[model samples]
Target: SQQGEEDPQALSIQEGENATMNCSYKTSINNLQWYRQNSGRGLVHLILIRSNEREKHSGRLRVTLDTSKKSSSLLITASRAADTASYFCATDFKETSGSRLTFGEGTQLTVNP
Candidate 1:
């Protein structure tokens, strides 16, 4: 099993501003993924980048991975107040069947209007 840690713990920004979050892991992984969670709700997958890939983008979301550094980052462009939520990074260990993800603590994002 692998573990992940998120930095800055929390973030605050105004609507239309961009938000960035980072994650670090302790072990080799098959892939890394990012997810968003509204308060008291289930997590929604945002993006995934494989160990062989460096970066990926989806709509207003961008994700970057550095397998060598065992770290990853997520960027949200033109963030909105509706973007206020918790962001998490997860790792899928190569040793496992990749059925589960080891999640980071999470970054609490607050977007003010």
Candidate 2:
């Protein structure tokens, strides 16, 4: 359980709003990465932060890490309908089980116009 398991399996937002999701894991990690996936578009890397880092932001997205509690959070600001997609958190450890990422059930986000 070194990977992340997100809560709130789904979320809906109106255009120009914001969305937030939380993730919790069970073991130490080297780094964590967030990814987004749209209907037709493939999974895109949104951001990544190492275990030593506390917070990271990119564009309208912000991520925070709390290693002591083994948890993380992702926030999207000014969300647009076009932002409708699924967001996933992944972890990379110094010792991986063959470089494979364990994914959770995922949180589906939809931004309505």
Candidate 3:
């Protein structure tokens, strides 16, 4: 079953502009991870923010988690055309269910050059 739901089904932006994506989840999570996919192919791990972590950053990506609200947000700074891709939030609830990862529908981001 899907656990995460991303806000704003799609986004379009010009190169150099920042892009922000939000995700909401239904239940408690151990860790929330972000990934980037190109052309609907393999996903590249962007970052993973644990339930104990309120925020984390990697390179140009910044992620914030609010367990109280059961939500998370990702921000990409200095967006480029190469950054155009689908972003997904995934969570593993091994504490409740067996080891299985549930993913969000994803947010398709378009960065125009």
Q: Candidate 2, which ten residues in sequence have the lowest lDDT sum?
A: 93-102
lDDT of 2 at 11: 95
Per-model TM-score versus the true fold? 0.94, 0.90, 0.94
**Worst lDDT window (10 residues) for model 1?**
93-102
Question: What would the per-residue lDDT of candidate 1 be over residues 1-113, giving only the tens digit for each residue?
Answer: 37789987999999999999999998888899999999989999999999999999999999999999999999999999999999999998665454678899999999999
Q: Using alpha carbons, what is the TM-score of model 3?
A: 0.94
Model 3, 7-113: lDDT tens digits are 88899999999999999998888899999999948999899999999989999999999999999999999999999999999986676456766899999999999
Off by over 4 Å in 2: 96-98
User: Please, what is the whole-model Cα lDDT of each candidate in the order they appear?
Assistant: 0.92, 0.86, 0.92
- Please give the lDDT score for candidate 2: 0.86
